[model samples]
Target chain A: MNGVRKAQTSPARSRFRDEDLPGYLFMAPWILGFLLFTLGPTLASLGLAFTKFDLLSPPQWIGVDNFTFMFTQDQRFWNALRVTFVYLLLEVPLKLAFALAIAMAMDKGIRGGDLYRALFYVPSLLGGSVAIAVLWRQLFQGDGVVNQVLLWLFGVQGPSWISNPETSLYTLVILAVWQFGSPMIIFLAGLRQIPAELYEAASIDGATRWKQFWRITLPLLAPVLFFNIVFQTIEAFKAFTPAFIISGGTGGPVDSTLFYTLYLYQEAFAHFRMGYASALAWVLLVIIGVCTTLSFLASKYWVFYEDER
Target chain B: MSAEAGPGQVGSEPTIVGVIARHVLLIAGSVLMLYPLLWMLASSFKPEAGIFSNLSLIPPSLNPKNYIDGWNALEVSFSRFYWNSFLIAILVVIGNVMSCSLTAYAFARLRFRGRNILFALMMMTLMLPYHVTLIPQYVLFLNIGWIDTILPLVVPKFLAVDAFFIFLMVQFFRGLPRELDEAAKIDGCGPWRIYWMIILPLSKPVLATAAIFSFLWTWNDFFGPLIYLNDISRYTVPLALRAFVDSTGTSAWGQLFAMSTLAIAPIFLFFLLFQRLIIRGVAMSGLKG
Candidate 1:
């Protein structure tokens, strides 16, 4: 398919030399933006990592010092990293499982499925949002509605979920899990793509519903599952707004909710440690890159893309 | 892998029981999901003490002053914040539609030296968390004196800097039939003309998709406003909402809830307006496109 299209375009390429120019012209704004916004800052940050470049002052070059501080001296960086990893580990698998289960159930042609899907998706739209996070702060506060409900139901006392270190992070984790909408929508789309004939054939062989799911549905949905997993995992790591907003940008309660990105934000902006923050950013980039590469490698064993080489 | 009860055996168990169980789960789940919003609405009408005292979904008395106080006490003009968010969202939609679709068309159709490499780079940008570049970008904006303005927030989107949107457009562009481009070319058209005359017209579904996403992301982008805009008067809705979160005075649960509800209402309305298209776009973008 690629060869045919290339040949067709190649022969008449000269007739459409103007075509390429227009495409580039249309793309000029983006090219300019890529250079200024993304590339410029990205490179500057790398350079700044080896130096102290507070906003108010000129950068002072101190090679490898910031790196040494982060790795060997900064316990907070490691703490943030550990907090982020735990958040990622718990959030990703639970979200994927819940999303998939909900999608599968909705795909069963139940009544009012669209409404159910919409309800399921609303939290996702609101999940990372400040307003929702603020609302979450209220709902989980010491005298907030959640604890009040617990009081009414079990007559058992509950800690302030968003104020206490032990439960504050869990509130954010639950919020992360609630935004299972996007993945659920994707899974529904994937489930619908499977040939109905496969399910029919399985049923003809007297296969149970559970067996059919394992043999047919699960295999067919693996590619979509892979996409959801990678995106969600990265997103979980990148989660900041909830922690930032709910904890009032302190990630407080003893910094229990101090996610890596939040800590990076604090370092860069709050402390004006531009050099250190840059190193932290690069480290995060490397971690994400390594994680994604590993996921891609692992996918070869499980994810079955259609029309693969 | 069949369980103790197979399909036929499962059918022997009362079908009514299974159906009832499904209904119970769905209803219970729905209630759990909607409870927070329900409580928020109820609490907004309640008196300040009632907010913490009563856990009822129904408040005893409605204190309409929450809405009034929230509107009156806002440091930045609430109407202005709305306008700012609206202006930013509209510009983002316009920028994304033009730039994203054009770049996507290039990646999907046109061949150029380093095309594959550039496309791969674009995908690589997707994996780089925004925090990595966020501070540096803020510093650059500060240097250029674009801080305290919406330019830093709105302008970068025009450059296809948002890899997710670019990738989304690329997938949609690839899905279009090559025959459309062929026919357009045969009609004395070049790539730009084809994009204008053929591709843009057929791209409504995806364009709407991009529009809805750009709108939502820009509207909810608190970090951008938080980092760049120091002037409270220049605040967007999200930043404006933060005013209710006080360290000195009492936390205005009533007013905060009221403003949050007001802030959330329009976006919810937008979602409802574009529900089908947005859902279709999401499904397509994630599933195959």
Candidate 2:
């Protein structure tokens, strides 16, 4: 298909002896951006990871010291890693499951599905803002609506989820899970793409609905499900704002909510430890890369594409 | 492998009781989702004493003082923050649309050396975490004295840094038939003329999608402004809202909630106006992602 299109465009392309000039011209801004913003910065950060530079002075060569300290000395680094991973494990699965359940429900041709969808999706739209973070902080406060409702309904007193070190990270996880609307939409789209005839045939063959689900739905939606896993995993790792907002930029309550990126921010911006921050950033890249790689490898066992047949 | 045949059809319990149960689940889920936001919206109008005292969404009596006070409560005021945010968002939208469309047109239509390889590299960057690129980019901007200004936030958009939009536009441009380009070329329309007169005119939906998304993301952005801008006066809405949190004690929850309500009002308006477009954009982008 691509080869045919390329051959067809060759005559039009050869109209100018400088055929690639137009393409090159169009790509000029991106190429410049690639150099100044992406490639240059990426390489420079990698180099800076090896040196001890503050913004105030030239970087001093520090071979493996930063890594040594991070691995051996930094308790907060481990805490950040633990906090981020815990958030990821809880948030991603719960979000995906909730989204999938809702997506499945929406697919049933319920009354006013669009209105229901609109209602469900508003949180994902507004979830990223500081406003929502502030609202979350308020809601999870000791005297906030959550506790109020718990007392009113269950007659049980609730702890201040946002401030208590035991439960602070869980509040952020809950916040992340609430914004399942995007994945829900994706799952809905994937569900819609499945031909209706298959279900019709399955039902005609005396296959029970439960059997149909376990035997059909889960595997067919695997690609979309896998995409959501990878996408939301990356997002959860990069999550900083809510933690920042709720913890008041301190990642406080004894660093229970110290997100990896927030810690990196404190290192780079707060402390001006440029070299250390660069090392931290490189470590983040590796973590994300590892997560992505692991997902893809696991996907080989379950994820199926249409063309594979 | 038989799971590939039929994806979930809501597990189709078509009985009346089943339908009612599903509706109950959905409505309950949506209410659970929207309660916090609606509660915040309702609480924004309440006085400080009434905010937490009443678990109900309704205020005892409507009050606009929170809105009034919150607007001026911050050192720089919410109005200035709104203006700053709008300025940055508008510039970002224009820059992203222009640069991403240009880059996308090149990839979608024109045949060039290393085009395939370059396209692959661009796609790979879609997954490349911004953290890796952030530190050096920050240092670069600091060295160029772009820090504490909107330049660090606004300048990158103009350079087509958003590769996802480029991928999106490429998908769109590929869907346009080659017949029009052929006719334009037959009339001696060169690549530029063909791109401008033929392709772009037929490409409104993709362009609109890109624009709306660019506008929305820039408007809601927190990290970029948090890192780059220093002064409260230059702060965007998100930063300003954070400042309200920092400056005020518990006496000001009313004012904080009020400004927070106002901060998300524009986004809520945008969602109301362009809900379908925005949802479709999310699905489209998610597929690409």
Candidate 3:
């Protein structure tokens, strides 16, 4: 297909020589943006990572000191890292599981599926906003709805979910899980792509529905699942707004909800430790890079692309 | 791996038990998902003292006092925040649709030298977390005195910094039958004319998707406005909403909820009206990426 197009376009190639100016002209905005916003700042941050710069004064060359301090001296750095990983571990699987189950249910051809999907997706639409975060704070307060429900149902007083250090991170995790609509939508689309005949064939062979799911659906859905996992994992890692707002921008109550990005923000803006924050940013970049690379590597074993088959 | 009993197959007239069970589960989950929002809406209409005293979504009385009080609760009236948010979101939508489609058209239809490398770099930007670029971008903007203005938030959109939309439109433009472009070319429609006339008209769905998402994300964005604009008068909805709650002192919970409902109302309405486009966008972007 591509070969034929290339051959056809070969005659147009001569025209493209003249068209090159317009092509680059069309691309001017993105090219300019890439150079200014993405490439330039990325390179600048790399340089800033090696210097001791506060915004008030000029940067002094500090060879590897910021990284050394982050690794050796900053317990909060480790705490932020641990908090982020824990959030990722807890949030991604639970959110995906919730999304998948709801998607499967929706796939069964329920009535008003559109309405249900819309209702289910509303939280995600509003999930990252300051209003939702503020609402979450109120909902999880000691005397809030969550505790009120607990008290009414089980006759037991519940701890302040958002304020307590031990459970604070979980509140954010719950918030993350609540916004499973995006993954659910993707999963639903994936589910629809599975040929109905596959299930019909399995049923004819006396394969139970569960067996058909394991035999047909799971394998077919693996690629979509993998996409959601990697996407959601990266999102979970960079999660800041909920934690930032829930903890009042302090990441406080002994830093329980101190997300990595929030901590980076605090270090850069609050403390004006631009160099250290730059190091933190680079570390985050490396971590995300490593995680994405590992997922792609691991996908070879599990992810089953339809075209590959 | 078959469950004890699977839900009935699609297109085979589902059983009553299956339908009932499905609605039961869906409604249960939907309530859980929507309860917080409902509570907020209910709390917004409740009296100040009644907000925390009860868990009921029903307000004792439908009072407009919270809405009235919250309108001017901040230093600037809530209308200013709404105007700032709407203005920024509209600009962002216009900028993203205009620029991303142009970029996507170039990559999809008009190949130039170094196109492959440039395309790969654009994709890489999708994975690069904003944090890596935040400080330097902030410094760059700061040096240029663009900080505290809407320029930092609005200018990047016009520059097509959002690669997701570019990738989305690329996928869309590639799906367009090449015959149309060829037909246009034979008629002496140059690349620019073909793009503006043929591609843009045929690409309404993706363009609408991009516009909706750009609008939604920009309106809900907190961190950008938070970092760039420090002045209360310049605050967007998200930032202004945050100002309602004074952690140290008394926060007017009813008024906060009132304002929050106002802040989220437009987005909710947008989602309802264009849910199909938004969901399609998510599915397309996720699967393709």
Instruction: Kindly list the per-residue Cα lDDT of model 3 for residues B1-289, writing each as its tens digit.
Output: 2232234363245667766777889999999888888999999999888887688878888989999999998779999999999999999999999999999999999867878999999999999999999999999999999999999999999999999999999999999999999998767687889998999999999999999999999999999998999999899999998877753223588888898899999998898789889989988977857
- CA shift of B186, model 2, Å: 1.3
Residue B34 error, candidate 3, Å:
0.9
Question: TM-score per candidate, in order?
Answer: 0.93, 0.95, 0.96
- Candidate 3 clashes: the total is 2
DockQ of every candidate structure: 0.49, 0.57, 0.68
Q: Model 1, range B182-207, lDDT digits (tens) per residue?
A: 88766767677888888889888888
Ranking by DockQ: 3, 2, 1
User: Which 10-residue window of candidate 1 chain A scores lowest in summed lDDT?
Assistant: A14-23
Consecutive 10-residue window with the lowest summed lDDT within model 1 chain B: B1-10
A29-83 in candidate 2: lDDT tens per residue?
Answer: 9999988899899999998998998888888999889999999999989999999
What lDDT does the true structure give each of the candidates? 0.80, 0.87, 0.88
* Chain A TM-score, each candidate: 0.93, 0.94, 0.95
Proportion of native contacts present in model 1: 0.47
Query: 1 or 2, which is superior by lDDT?
Result: 2
Which has the better lDDT: candidate 1, or candidate 3?
3
Residue B203 CA error for candidate 3 (Å)? 0.9
lDDT at residue B41 of model 1 (Cα atoms):
84
Predicted structure with the largest TM-score when compared to the true one: 3
